[model samples]
Target: MKLQSTPPIPASDRQSPPAVLTLGPASCDAAILAQLLPVAERFRLNSAHLDPGGLVGWLDRLEALFEAEGRSVPVVVDLQGAKMRIGRFPSIPRLPGRVELVPGDRSERADTIPVPHPGLFRHAAPGDRLFLNDARVELEIERVGDERIGARTVRNGPLEASKGINRAPHPLPFEALSDRDASMIDASIGRPFVEYALSFVRSAQDAGLLRPRLGGHRLIAKLERTEAIAHVREIDAAFDESWLCRGDLGAQAGVGELGPIQRRIATLIPSLRNPCYLAGQVLEHMTHFPEPTRSEVVHLYEVARSGFAGVVLSDETAIGRHVAEVAGFLARAAPEE
Candidate 1:
């Protein structure tokens, strides 16, 4: 199915706005809740790095926090689906030079490395590309051997392990949930007030697997990969809601291409009638500094003007020290009559 345009934000509802914020387990503390929940429309708990036990507690705190304020906020639990990524090293030095990917290197200190994901080796071939650290750097598969795959930097940057890795040119043949993600999903079952965000949905098949796991709750497919873009219509047909994850998207398609992709996704996902959010780096400064950048503010307005349903503040709210300030900024910056 072709994508459709988002309905205009109702003039009446424009007077009040909805902005979504993602909170990490650490950020779910009562202090942060006291300042954030009243203004946020939704809270996304990212399950990528969080342990199962920690996530449960985060959910509990989220409920109590909202209740204390005499309001109920929607909770989105983002499952770390079948996306391929490198595990973290003890301390990844900020290498000034490019780190090559070599086969059979098990030691932690090797300049070239072997990722723990055996599936990556099985699927990646020469000429394919891999995205690292939100696409800040690119690694090209130079060779595919019996035991491993070799890659070289196409774009130069310092990379640490545990930064996300994605294959390019073709989608990998595998389930969306890694073993760790499966564990997280199992732990999250039967949780109240939690919606599931399925990441890297490339086709209807991906959505099909996710639907059964969702246990009758809402599932929002996060469309980020090029394959997902190509098969968006099918994925949209399979799921009720979608989020255009523009951060990893910019990495896959370059920053310049993001706008058109966003427009296209907004058009295709009929259920996503709100502003297909232009997420990632919207308030990156707030992650370290207490204030948002002027450019970030402009981008936020751009997203609002485009009529996005909501914007997600990931690292800005999750790990950042300025969670409350970022939440407040989005609440105030949102379009209000």
Candidate 2:
């Protein structure tokens, strides 16, 4: 599909702390992608959402589109590494009540949420806290049974299927590289523009283990686990870059603590060797509105001041209502450049 030809982005309009655009289902639409791609400094694709073949096809299209533009943007194939997600279940209108947790990808019952990852069951215990759907819903474990675990929602909210699950303070007993991640990385070989971003990274060793598989492609360590923050220096050294994914980080740490955690990491960026980018929920309100909340704009400038090399827009650019407007806002807010 030919992208409608457009003028090149002006140097001044390019964000100072560059903006990385994350691709989602909505981004697959040609019209939507045409509106979003030019302003992006880099592209991020979640591996879980696309199979190897489909991903290559998407990459081909992206390359073609960029070829038309006379420039290319690096693509980051985001690996799901060690992240635990609940499987498919009908959306619950109201949460905060007791729910059952079982292991599988599909749950037929409304009260049951499929965890699908055995590591969670093996490590979870009574009284442990579980955060789901980015901590909009919080669960307190009531019992850990042989086949199913029981949890009561301490915080009330709606629940959705296939959302991320985080058990913080207690490390999830999963390795950094999942089988799917390994396969996807292997499939991505020989693609010069393709790089890998490892998710849920907890230690430098996790980054170390995945390094050999990339054949020296640049790796970006996503620091979401609270455990990772303590070892940020070592982890930073292991990767070409690091992403401070505030969404899961906030979910793991208390949401109320995200600001403090982000600021603390900001102070450490100057000491780190690799570039660190602020990610997750930047200009989130733009997902539904044409303009971002004033506070969100202020936060972008604050991140720039904190020495973040860039900011990643997830839902904002992926499924947002005003994609071009969102990108323009980020560019206009660029720090003195």
Candidate 3:
């Protein structure tokens, strides 16, 4: 009945390269890596979560511990590039009527929530589903205009402010790098494994822009956008590895495309032999639940079976309650060695 435990990983499997399990930035315990040094494949730090000083401290500690323990994992910093987010809105625990999803600024009216970016409206149309923050709060776009977007909640739940907004894949165009991303990359220079992972990469050109910022460190092209997948080979060539950030992909990809897309990318990475990892909503419910759902287990197994180098956990470890347990599942859950 234990959801966390799968069949034991065969001895041969344990000897193989451990699946690269990535923990998110919210996992500031810093020492968690040392504790699970053998389990983790990489640690992901977000720019918004820590300043330059804090990052250096954690990196130093983990690297030093690895040296002493003869164990180490790469630390990947997400530039948050091309991650479109909505502006601040009140915690609408329940539904609000006729909310004006405004653009360019926050709204004074309680009924309004601005999405500073104008591009969201450009590609989105009436009836397109919008997922805010998480899948909990879904909106069906009823109106898209020059000034505001109006959507009625499809799945009523609490809505948080300043979280990412994901719409159906509809040519949602934008630059890959922000000025802030450049600054973080500049600040992260010289740190071990301060390697840059560009999110929502659309094309090889987008991935190419990050090389200068990477300072010759590894470049991980995260394929989430539908556009990016279209140019998968070019982007794959432009970077050292590929990343399947499925949570965003689910939100951005058409519902039907999700399955085929996952299969294609999962199939594509192994052939490239570029140390790819699968992430997003992998263990979403395991944060509080004692065991993961049936679907979650199958998904993790699929990741392991894909013959990729690793799989990643975002919220599962970042803000989730059961970080270690989930990592234990991935670290230990392998097929035959």
Candidate 4:
């Protein structure tokens, strides 16, 4: 297969912080990618969200587009790690008004939803909370049954298929990488992929466990949990790079400490010679607005001052009204002029 062309790196980009633009959530779609890539070509957000299952199709299409346009970009595959996801249930006439958590990896029945791991059963109890899809949907367990747990929703919104599930920050006796993540890495054995975004890294063990799977690929240890923060130095040493993913980190570090902790982590990585990326909520307001908020402007300056090698966007580029505009502002902030 023909590799996409590697464009000359301008002196400006060499001196500026690199930005990686993400494809839209359903960005896997060929048409959506068609719309997004032209913008990516212009702004040069080299790194993109590459996951396992959809890797080949996206690469084929991306290669065609970039080859046609005469460009190439780095691919970063983000591993889901041991983060828990609500299991699949067949669609009912309507989802139960009551939320349910049943055991197993999948379900096709009514009312009872699948929670997959039996280990979670030990931690959960009545009146405890369950956060689904990054807290977009909340389930407060009213009662726990022998077979299933039932709850009522506190926050209701659009829920994605395979949304993540979590309670509070408690240490699970498991490695950060999930079986699924390992299989994914194994599948990508010979692809010239650039990096692995190892998720849920909580300790040096978490980082070390994944380093071998990467097969010498760049490792971006995502510091999302407080445990990762507590042991940042070792985790930093174990990986080639680090990322401060504020969304999940907020859950692990307490929302109050997300900002301070993000700054602190960003400050630490540069001294270790491990470049860090500031991800999440960088241009969140731009998803709706024509212009960036004053705070967003300040946030960019904070990123640069703290020595982040790059900034990452999720909604701002993926689902934002102005994907290219958001990319432009980010480029301006850390100009590749």
Report RMSD for candidate 3.
5.0
**lDDT tens digits by residue: candidate 1, 87-117:** 6543453432445554432447645555666
Better of 1 and 2 by TM-score: 2
lDDT of 2 by residue, 45-96 (tens): 8876677887888888888878776778899998888887788878877763
Model 2, position 55, has a per-residue lDDT of 83
Model 3 clash count equals: 3
Which prediction has more favorable TM-score, 3 or 4?
3
- My TM-score estimates for the predictions, one after another, are 0.83, 0.90, 0.80, 0.78
Clash counts for all predictions: 10, 0, 3, 0
Ranking by lDDT: 2, 1, 3, 4
Candidate 4: 10-residue stretch with minimal lDDT: 41-50
TM-score of 1: 0.83
lDDT of 4: 0.66
Candidate 1 local lDDT, residue 290: 74
Tell me the alpha-carbon RMSD of every candidate. 6.8, 7.0, 5.0, 8.6
Off by over 4 Å in 1: 1-17, 96-107, 110-114, 174-176, 267-276, 334-337
lDDT of 4 by residue, 72-123 (tens): 6666667766567767756443345687788886776656678766767876
The better candidate by lDDT, 2 or 4, is 2
